[model samples]
Target chain A: MELKVYVDRLSQPSRAIVIFCKVNKIDFEEVGIELLKGQHLTPEFKEINPMGKVPAIVVDGKFKLFESHAILIFLASAFPGVADHWYPADLYRRAEIHSILDWHHSNLRHGSSFTYFPFPHELCSDETNVFQLNASSAGFIQNTLLAPLFGRSLNPQAAAEAEKVLSSSLSKIEALWLKESGQFLLGSSQPSIADLCLVCEIMQLEFADETDRNRILGPHKKIQQWIEDTKSATKPHFDEVHQTLFAAKVKLQMQRK
Target chain B: MELKVYVDRLSQPSRAIVIFCKVNKIDFEEVGIELLKGQHLTPEFKEINPMGKVPAIVVDGKFKLFESHAILIFLASAFPGVADHWYPADLYRRAEIHSILDWHHSNLRHGSSFTYFPFPHELCSDETNVFQLNASSAGFIQNTLLAPLFGRSLNPQAAAEAEKVLSSSLSKIEALWLKESGQFLLGSSQPSIADLCLVCEIMQLEFADETDRNRILGPHKKIQQWIEDTKSATKPHFDEVHQTLFAAKVKLQMQRK
Candidate 1:
């Protein structure tokens, strides 16, 4: 049996996997579990993933895997010919990739975590839980992550200096767009898992619509240009099949509304 | 240059890697990073690991790897003699192992996180991040993990009822502990990466003294018994190396007192 990816394009990890499969030409089946319908909470899905989260998969009827980073690494490991750069065999280069993956959960993951979705689970429940669904969580990120780090960022702001770097995380990315020397981050090398990660995270950030283009990704000159440039490179992958899935997802959201 | 393991035996992930190296018989030099001295926070080590965490390795003069589970999988992939069962060659089985590695972070790792030394940096400044190091961050596991599934675990009320199984998460493991059985967790198997993870997580529930013993791990039968048996089974890697580290760690705490 071929590989099967159980995904919802709405999920950042799921999008990463879809893009990876497209770029690498991996043939697999697609199974969508609607998050809004609470399908993930169902017992059947729980058997596949006790955590009841998405971006899970069933491989050859024998193994079930969760955690997007782990899955991405596994795919690259199993497919060697993808290129030496994607996951280099050399120690330091491999270590560099590993380092990025490691930093992700604590850093980039935090950025992704703060974005808000329109769920009422935390608020509707007891006051003690204090967990906000999606949007407020994004606000949580702005304060805990974007705000403080930005305040402490690149420029030595006389005041609010920290905030300048905050936007560039988004904008510096835009600056990279301006300097399209390489198809992916980490230079003209084959896009490593980091590229997949950035695409999802950037998409999620843009989804928030809070990012101001000019100062953030734009100010860097390269990142702003790179941001749009990277998206365009991957445009063909998301075209025929991805558009259908994306439209269907939008319809699903409207139905929820 | 040979591989170098930077470890403190008392740490969970550190012990897992140490045990893997011993069991696999991979040759390596040992270098200690003094956790008590706060060596990890130093500028020099930061270059080695930006995360400033334990159980890191510098492999073959170049690769520096952190995150114990990731290291464990890498070792399995890098070393030829290590049984495939530990990591598994089949895609799905590997995925199952990967799932646990990921889930363990929120489940088993969460359980383990609750059992910290509760150390703080400043009685002088009264900066109470230490006091605020609430085990409560891990309370979700009690409600979600132990109460429903494991039953009687660390529950003060059921402390006596489920004492045996509750103590070690290994009462059933008694059957698996026999010498002649020879196999490890999966079957008459040496052990898979899954076993490595469990060994690491279980070790974290250990405490320093009699008072601590009464607190949780000591009072419970299954838990205590499991700790004893497993530690005995893996004696060489720990009692020799980890015990030394553990003693020094205790001494450091006593000095603080």
Candidate 2:
């Protein structure tokens, strides 16, 4: 069985899937779909995922799937060598993970630095760039990081609102999911897909200005430690998959100077 | 094993879980948490779901779970006599359904009429109502239907923006999931949990003023038919669970006169 993962590492969920595959030793070819270049929107890519989103996969060149949570579940369930802890076979445990994954979308994903970008058309003359960045999957970077990177002022109100939601989300995670003893979410000894997915999401804040990133993430000490724990558990693969985003972050900092 | 489902039929996902249990003949007690009355915010409900959202469940008075999609999956997986089509044991088929369910949160739920409500504080002097409605789960009705019902003008820009996202989401669902031969999503012969979840989400449009509701939902003929098909498949339970929403719709229409 051949598997091909189409991804753009800059996208949070895309990075999560890539890191998961690497850590689990899932044999698959990583096919990059550049969000900035409009690669995901091309007709050829659309055939793989008609939604025109990345972090999609094709198996044996016939079956196709999109949505990172689904792809992670499929990978965990279908792959033979993947540890059960990644997605436990136990019905109750799996359902608990699913609850976090589902909640992540609307709350953490929606409220985090990744809130959908509403580009002001007048500010950006390049229609192609605007359109590509407008795609929901790619909207995050443009909204939180790219705007400032490109010398466009971030909308203060939107930023404030996003920060408020993000802060509240972090607090909830700290109070509800993180336990006093457990290293991972829900007190699990091993990291689940929920950990990988949410950690990747919070990692997107690395692209934000250091002050803003710290301000938003600072209060939640447990979440910060949990993120570190998840990264450590995943080993070199976590940082390996995030190289693109980290590089971009350095570039943004350099450009700011 | 005893199961208790905490829900409010007025919430779309809450109703979906209720309908799923009733249709599958799963023995569960439904505990209503009235969102409007701030019942979900109380200390007791938080014990059931620390996140304080409805559509949570407790199993045998010990284990608790939240998130409607997760709850539905748990119900389908944990309970006997639930048809396979609802959540197939087949890895690929279940993954396909998961893809849609995950997508529903960010794209369909976020973009549809249920986009998070940012109520203008001064517009409503009743602090309690504002606080209760501000809770993410209960925000939808206030934004689309209740605002107008209570004589507040809907923000045109936000409405237009929501419509654009909703339209694009519906189009994607039509082009990608619906097939000419099948009545349910992903061309399944029987309705899956994906069908029930999405159909219930779109059904929230019924609370919108008729012209806006029809105008927004009118273009997607396949989706319209699919919603009907799913309703028929689920039988009396579908409409039975939605009675609260439907009744509220009637009240809204009466007030508009």
Candidate 3:
């Protein structure tokens, strides 16, 4: 039996895993957990991942793994001969990649919070539905959803605060981290899993209001170009996996119309 | 010539490196960076590490590496024969370690924020002196120093807030991650680098007020025992490297008296 990859395409990490598996041609079954529908909360999914988070995998029907970084490393190591570049063999280079991934959790990953908090109402059909959705879920409601933002209304100050955080995050990436890497981080010719993790994160900004997205990402040219370069390098796999996000955006636009 | 580890023992991650190197008997020269004196701000140190953080290593006096997680992994891979359990050979186990390290940055590691923000006054001798220290520095001041905390006064609300964050963090570790581990995470008889990282982080909470420390750590009996076990496992090396923090705490207590 092939490995089972449980993911919700709308989740950034999920998209990265799908892209990785597809680009590397790793044999796996893709199981979708729709976050919007609370499918991840189902007991069956809970049995697979007690954390109720996507981007989890069960390998060979035995070992269960969560955390996108771990999952990426597992896939890379398990299929080393095939997917060598996603994770490198060189000790120092691989360390740099590891450092980037670790640093990412607090830094660039803040983009997720900034993206959702600014425009939560727009993410769902209506405010009532958003609250009802949260009410139905047991335990904690997942972040980056509409419910958390309902406690605080959207205002200029909130937008500015989010922009400040998002911009600072992007600036650190541009100034501090990517100076060595011309096109990709750590100077890799091909995109690494770090690149996938970051691009997917920045892509979340697209789900934000257009004004906020441009304000936050507009000043950082290097980051914008790096995102494009990562996409171009990855090509069809990148586009294919991200279609869900694109579809959601189009649907939101139609709803507004 | 040996690998050079630049560190300030007061820093949690820096202490982890010192303990790791000493325990493993890795041939490395310990280069001290006096964070309290603004040594990290010097242009010379900046050339070595622009980020101005300690726990950086220069291998063979050439390739410079930063980020304690990266440095730990680099040491593990470079000297694999010496310390096997620190980072395991088993792919799944290593992946779990990676996940913990990555999860740490946002979860348990937020202890840094809670620790410093709660006790701003006792950290320095005087407010004027703290400003002078910051003004003299050419670069950013190191964390766990008196400067950043000096600006904010201690309050019950701050302590409560820190406790809330800290408690929520500890609960997740107890309920979710450590289900499989016997004494150490991942069920190893010996503690891994994940143990070093986490224990070092929790140790920082000790610097908080006794009341705050009890409130923060009191509920989690397993975590407290794990800390003791990790200390026992690491032993004299752990005590030796932590001397600086211990002294600082003593000084703070004396001042309060």
Q: Which DockQ values do the candidates obtain, in the order shown?
A: 0.22, 0.59, 0.38
Per-residue accuracy of model 3 over B1-257 as CA lDDT, tens digit each: 36999887767888888899888888889999876666776798877776566767888777887788888988888885556789998888898898788767654654334433223222321111111222111111123233344563334443344455567778877776656658887677888999998888778665666775686678888888888888899888988888888887888666545
Worst 10 residues of 3 chain A by lDDT: A130-139
User: Could you give candidate 2's per-residue lDDT for residues B131-176 as a string of tens digits?
Assistant: 2333232343455555664567655554555677688889989988
Weakest 10 consecutive residues of candidate 2 chain A by summed lDDT: A122-131
> How many clashes does each candidate structure show, in the order listed?
38, 0, 1
Cα error, residue B36 of model 3, in Å, equals 3.0
Q: Of models 2 and 3, which has the larger DockQ?
A: 2
Give the interface RMSD of each candidate: 4.3, 3.7, 7.4
Ordered list by DockQ, greatest first: 2, 3, 1
Candidate with best DockQ: 2
Q: Which model is ahead, 1 or 2, in terms of DockQ?
A: 2
Q: What TM-score does candidate 3 get on C-alpha atoms? A: 0.83
Off by over 4 Å in 1: A60-63, A77-96, A121-188, A209-233, A238-257, B81-83, B121-188, B208-233, B244-257
**Sorted by TM-score, highest first, which candidate order results?**
2, 3, 1
Give per-residue lDDT, candidate 1, residue B138: 29
Query: In candidate 2, which residue ranges exceed 4 Å CA deviation?
Result: A115-154, B114-153
TM-scores for all candidates: the values are: 0.68, 0.89, 0.83
Over the full model, what C-alpha lDDT does candidate 2 score relative to the true structure? 0.76
> What digit string (tens of lDDT, one per residue) describes model 3 on residues A7-118?
8777788888888888888888999887667666679977877656677899888888888888898898887555567899888789888878766675456433443322
